[model samples]
Target: MSDFTTTRRSFAKGIGGTITLAALGSTASAQTAETWTTAETPTGNTLYDVERTANGVYAVGAGGIVLHRTDTGWERVLDGGPTGNGNSLYGADVTDDGERLWFVGASGAIGEMDVVSQSVDDHSAPDDVTNNFNDVAVTGVAGSANAYVAGDSGKVYYSFDDGATGTWDYTTPGSGSAVNAVDFYDARSGHIVDGNKSVFATDDGGTYDKIGLADANANFYAVDSDGADDVWIAGGGGMIHHWDGAQWTPADTGDASLRDIEVAGDDGLAVGGGGVVYGRDSDGWNRQSTPTGQNLKGVVRGGVDVAVGAGGTVIER
Candidate 1:
């Protein structure tokens, strides 16, 4: 196991509150134009993941909490989560068409939310396996996309039938090390990082081949893949690794471990411990200031940038 596995596992388990804020000034000259403001959340539960859809932005966290951001502000859409079982949701992703949102969580909890109807369909415990899921990725349209779920048991569960129970199947990509994050740039192509400090790539959705980062000392937590040539991974020791088809380059932002990252075209954002936010511009990745001191766990980058974390904390750029 990597040196940071125990620390990250504790953080993932110790996973609070709401407050609105004004634009904060940046201490770094590189991020003078970048400022983030906090949003008022309805619950104090720790949010694990956030994703943006056509309807708006949604964040999920402890006690099965799900919050939605509208034109006016944030609102609680589901209090007891997808199954009303109060499971802690850890990961979420929206479909390619932005019509549905898929979330995975503790106790094998899995759900799909319809953006237009605001209704959730529970798809938990597929194959009778009740292990906790860390993250998820969906490819294609809302109802027809393939779903890939990262498991704590070092397995990647996939469904081609929109998460239908019997359609679920899994493949082990690592040597029994927990798979932390998974992302797909296309229907059958994606990447995954695990606690063993290993990176794997799959083009056919099941079989995986070991990639680079073999000497990494930190456990990778999140990954953003744009293609076979464009991939970014965030993990312990404030490390960021990028794979451009040939080799993996590493960068250290600070001491705080990054939990999530998103890239849209040339612009990108990564969030992690101590409310640290990193912005990628034409030059390179630069740390940005945020309004909260709590650790950030998830981020979504696009027309509007938003991050959620430790508390019910929500911040936008």
Candidate 2:
């Protein structure tokens, strides 16, 4: 195996409790008061991913916990869904219209939720291909019918039927590094980032090409795309990298390990261990104040920005 693949596997195995040690408490003194406000959660489960839905925001976490935010506030939903299995959900995505929601998690679990009908369909990896799915992405306005899930051992699965009635086809890029996240900039172009400091891009859905990175030790956790040529990746050691169509450039975020990222237009936010939140703009990345000191795991932007993490923490901006 390549050094990159081996290093990533070792890092993943030793990441437990790292987030707690990385959090230096809230840096509220350096941030403005208008930046973030704490929201209540029904459980103390560690939330792993958040996404903007048609009606509001949804966050998924440990213990089968799923929370939805509407005008009223955040409420726990999907209690009877796959979350009840207690598998830790790691990533989520929604259709452009917010009518369909897809989430992937531990033990090869994949879930699809119908927003309007309040129903869920769940699937598991084939016995021969069992691996923990870390992230999921949906492409096109056609909804969740066409989706991708990235996971351990460099596994990537594609489904053309919303994962409701058909089997998903699987592929493995060359690295064999654990894939942390995936995003599609268009119907035919997508990107996946792995723990091995590698990025893979695909334009035709059948093949993925590894994109070179300057730092081979940087562990990327999440990825987002604003357009066909603009992409952002965030991860270990406060590392943030941008892809501007031709090349990847590192954007500094101090020393924190960013776990999730969301971008809308030129605006973007990355959240990570120790409640660290960084905002991006024309001036580049800047740290933002958050109300909690808990380790943040996921962030999403919509009518409002919401972040979720350890201690069932939830905050909005």
Please tell me which predicted candidate would have the highest TM-score against the true structure: 1
What's each prediction's clash count?
4, 3
Q: Which stretches of candidate 2 lie over 4 Å from their true place?
A: 1-33, 80-84, 126-128, 141-144, 164-166
TM-score per candidate, chains pooled: 0.89, 0.85
Any runs in candidate 1 off by more than 4 Å, and if so which?
1-29
Give the 10-residue window scoring lowest on summed lDDT in candidate 1: 7-16
Q: lDDT per residue, candidate 2, 138-169, as tens digits? A: 76443445778897878888876666445667
Candidate 1 C-alpha lDDT tens digits along 1-317: 01100111100000001112212223263546657899888888999988878788888899888899988899988877677888899999888878888899999989999977889999999998889999998887878989999999999999989998699999998798999998877677778889998878887788888775656779899988765566778899878877655566677776889999876556778889999898876666777768889999998865568899886899987
Compute the lDDT of residue 197 as modeled in candidate 1: 89
- The CA-based lDDT of model 1 is what? 0.79
TM-score of 2: 0.85
Q: Candidate 1, 145: how far from true, in Å?
A: 1.6
